[model samples]
Target: MNAHAATDTAASSTTALPLKEQLVLVTGGARGLGAAISAAFLDAGAKVVVNYRSSSQAAEELAAAFPGQALALQADVRDAAGLKDLAAAAAEHFGRPITTLVNNALVDFSFNADARSKADELSAEELTAQFAGSVLAPVAAIQAVLPSMRQAGFGRIVNIGTNLFQHPVVPYHDYTATKAALLSLTRTFADDLGPEGINVNMVSGGLLRTTDASAATPEEVFDLIASGTPLRRVTSPAELADAVLFFASPLSRGVTGQNLIVDGGLVKG
Candidate 1:
């Protein structure tokens, strides 16, 4: 293991950094876990920029709920120009650098095993498509924000991942492999950016009960997963979002380049 993982929480202590003191950016934040994370940040007193690829109405409504504290930005994470425009808009709207970023805008993928491409049948195109969302987009977003984060002398970046990478009970090959790549990038970013006062980390969750993606999942599958977990229930988007807040808060300032699995203890990392 890299020493960066051990050093991530070397500064962790009781209490938390003030959320109101931070400017935050959340990708794909219009709905689902993204919305939950955005709401949590707003409640914490931070100014937020909610980025979405489509779902304009939902984004508008979410931003409206927070009034002046939040703004809805339409940007496809895979587009460099859009990501840059988003950062610029956020800075202008909030009058400060974005101090925190949550890479939650997931590429379209069904969680159903039947719907997924098996390793034997999966193609290079499938892997590349997943990578576009899982890894490439994150790299673009980080590049878009790095100068501002460094200038501010503080930063917090949280990447959304899946517990499937740790335990591929169903082996969603393309999805899990992309996330595994992302996990590696998380640690790499933490290693490179830690000294610059930026903290990079990942929060991986198990199958969310009823997100749009998982709504296709069979009830029996949910039941089976729930029965297997110690908590006797799969995680909810809202519940997992709360855990994400910890990474953005000062409470985890010493933590970085590490993956926090929030899967009801189903698969202990």
Candidate 2:
């Protein structure tokens, strides 16, 4: 969509759903960066549905603290059938269709530079499994929420990505390839759905300092990154969540199909 069209839509949607009343569904919202993003949205007055494959206790605690504003739902992103059930449950519990969707779930967090794997070494099954969590799941969630979003003439889709896809400092072949594919999907989806008044974008970050996903990274490696990074430090979940909020808010109505990197300027491109 052109800038003019997007601007018009944003102005019209200003009061459609107040920040606290909008229904937002965040995948992998039980912990880590996902949990941080959930908290940011709730703080902005959005009613959030935290989707967790596991980590039920963590999800419950978050929901309890954000009472009447957050709901915890369990569904594996890789399972299309399960995602359908998740959508139904979210709609029932929130009493409103989801207006915002965040795809933040990942399958595995392997960052071993010593491990060697080439295209030839990867099997068809391995490739499919990787894409199922990284690409297919987000696409499915977008499809599930499109009808309601289109009817309402407002939607925000934020897909979480990784910095490795951009810098390739670590040779996580399967992981990097799948995330790159997801970036492509994000752009194409934005082009296709922009006419329906939906904005789709991505937030890519480097090695986060204190998340379960980043526990595998050796301390020395993190220190090396901190030394070389322009910011001279690792990123935090809250910092990344702030970037996400900008995309989900009215401020980013004109932004879509772009990868906003929050890696402390580690990857300039």
Measure candidate 2: CA RMSD. Answer: 3.4
Q: Compared with the true structure, what per-residue lDDT tens digits does model 1 show for residues 55-76? A: 8999999999989999999999
Tens digits of per-residue lDDT, candidate 2, 1-269, equal 99999987676674244556578889999899999999999999898999998899999999998999999999888888787788778888877878889999887656556553665686777678788888898888888777767666688899999888869877677778889999999999999988777889999998888788777778999899999888899999999999998888877877889999998999988
TM for candidate 1 is 0.93
Which residue segments of model 2 deviate by more than 4 Å?
Answer: 1-11, 14-18, 114-121
Lowest summed lDDT across 10 adjacent residues in model 2 is found at 12-21
Candidate 2 clashing pairs?
A: 19-45, 20-45
Which segments of model 1 are wrong by more than 4 Å? 1-17
Counting clashing residue pairs in each candidate, in order, gives 3, 2
Candidate 2: C-alpha lDDT: 0.85
Mind sharing the TM-score for model 2? 0.91
Cα error, residue 249 of model 2, in Å, equals 0.2
